[model samples]
Target: MYAPQADTRLLARALHAERITAGMDVLDVCTGSGALAVLASRLGARVSATDISWRAVMTARLNAARAGQRVQVRHGDLSMPWFGRTFDLVTSNPPYVPARDARPPTWGRSRAWDAGRDGRHVVDRICSHASALLRPRGVLLMVHSSLCDAGATLTRLEDAGLRASVTERARVPFGPVLTERLPWLRAQGLIGAEQDWEELVVIRAERS
Candidate 1:
């Protein structure tokens, strides 16, 4: 299961800032350990969460239970389980690290963070489908590394007909995974030669 990190914390803070009232529905995609889902439920929203890994699903369920919060946690691809349902709010902290592998890992610890080359394997899909999962005027809060290009996310969300912007940003030093990828990232022009940190951004998009 993916442990909560700076990206997750950033998303959680962003979610807490939203005006999520009682009875409002919230969906948390790529819910690694159900932290955000439980938080949303604590805020009085009806929370449902999904993850691609069964381990993560179980972990989320366990966390929710321990928190005394009711979160409907399921094992499925991002947003796949809630196809026909639209929520008042959606949240996600997906895999956004640029990786050596051309395709994201389907199984293993890497599945939690190793996205394809540009680190958008999951981000792009979320951008494409977020609007569809939200009710009119509903909101989507998602966090990702700026290495993937927050600009692209904004463009995609706007093209999806939702008003979007980077609502929060935090610079975090590179961890082991990123530290190992420094040379490749630098060669790919995803980071500056001396860059040892990444800027994480929380994108807020609203359905019109």
Candidate 2:
């Protein structure tokens, strides 16, 4: 399972900054360890979480139970399981790492972070559909690496009629995966030869 990391903490902080309160319906997409789901539950929101990984789904369910929070955990790709449902808040920390291969790994732990080519495989999908799952005035809080083209995400959300902006940013050292792929990333012109740090950003989009 993908453990909670800096990106997770950052997204959680962003979520809290939105001042989510009781009675809000929250959806945590790609809910890995369900950290965000439990946090939303603790904040008194009715929480639901979804993940493509069965292991992640189980982990999220167990985490919610341990936290004494009731979260509906579903196993599926992105928001496929939540058709016809709308939420007050939608949050996600999807796989945004650019992979060497054109396709993400079908199985294994690498599935947690491998996104095809430009790293927008899953990010793009989230940007395209998250607004549809939100109620009026609903907010979407998503965290991803700057390497994935934050501008594109903002534009996509705006095109979908959501008011979008980058709400937070932090420069962090490269993690193991990124470190291992530095050479390839440089060759692909996705990163500078000397770059050793990456910027993480949280984009908040609101439905009017």
Cα lDDT for residue 193, model 2? 80
In candidate 2, the residue pairs with backbone N, CA or C atoms under 3 Å apart (3 or more residues apart, or in different chains) clash, namely none
Candidate 2 regions off by >4 Å? none
Assess each prediction's global lDDT (C-alpha) against the native.
0.93, 0.93
TM-score of each: 0.98, 0.98
Residue 104 displacement in candidate 1 (angstroms) = 0.8
Model 2, total clashes: 0
Error of 1 at 2 (Å): 2.1
Candidate 1's residue-wise lDDT over 1-208, tens digit each?
6678888889888988997899999999999988899999999999999999999999999999999999998889999887799999999999999998889998999999999999999999999999889999999999999999999999999999999999999999998899987999999998999888999999999998
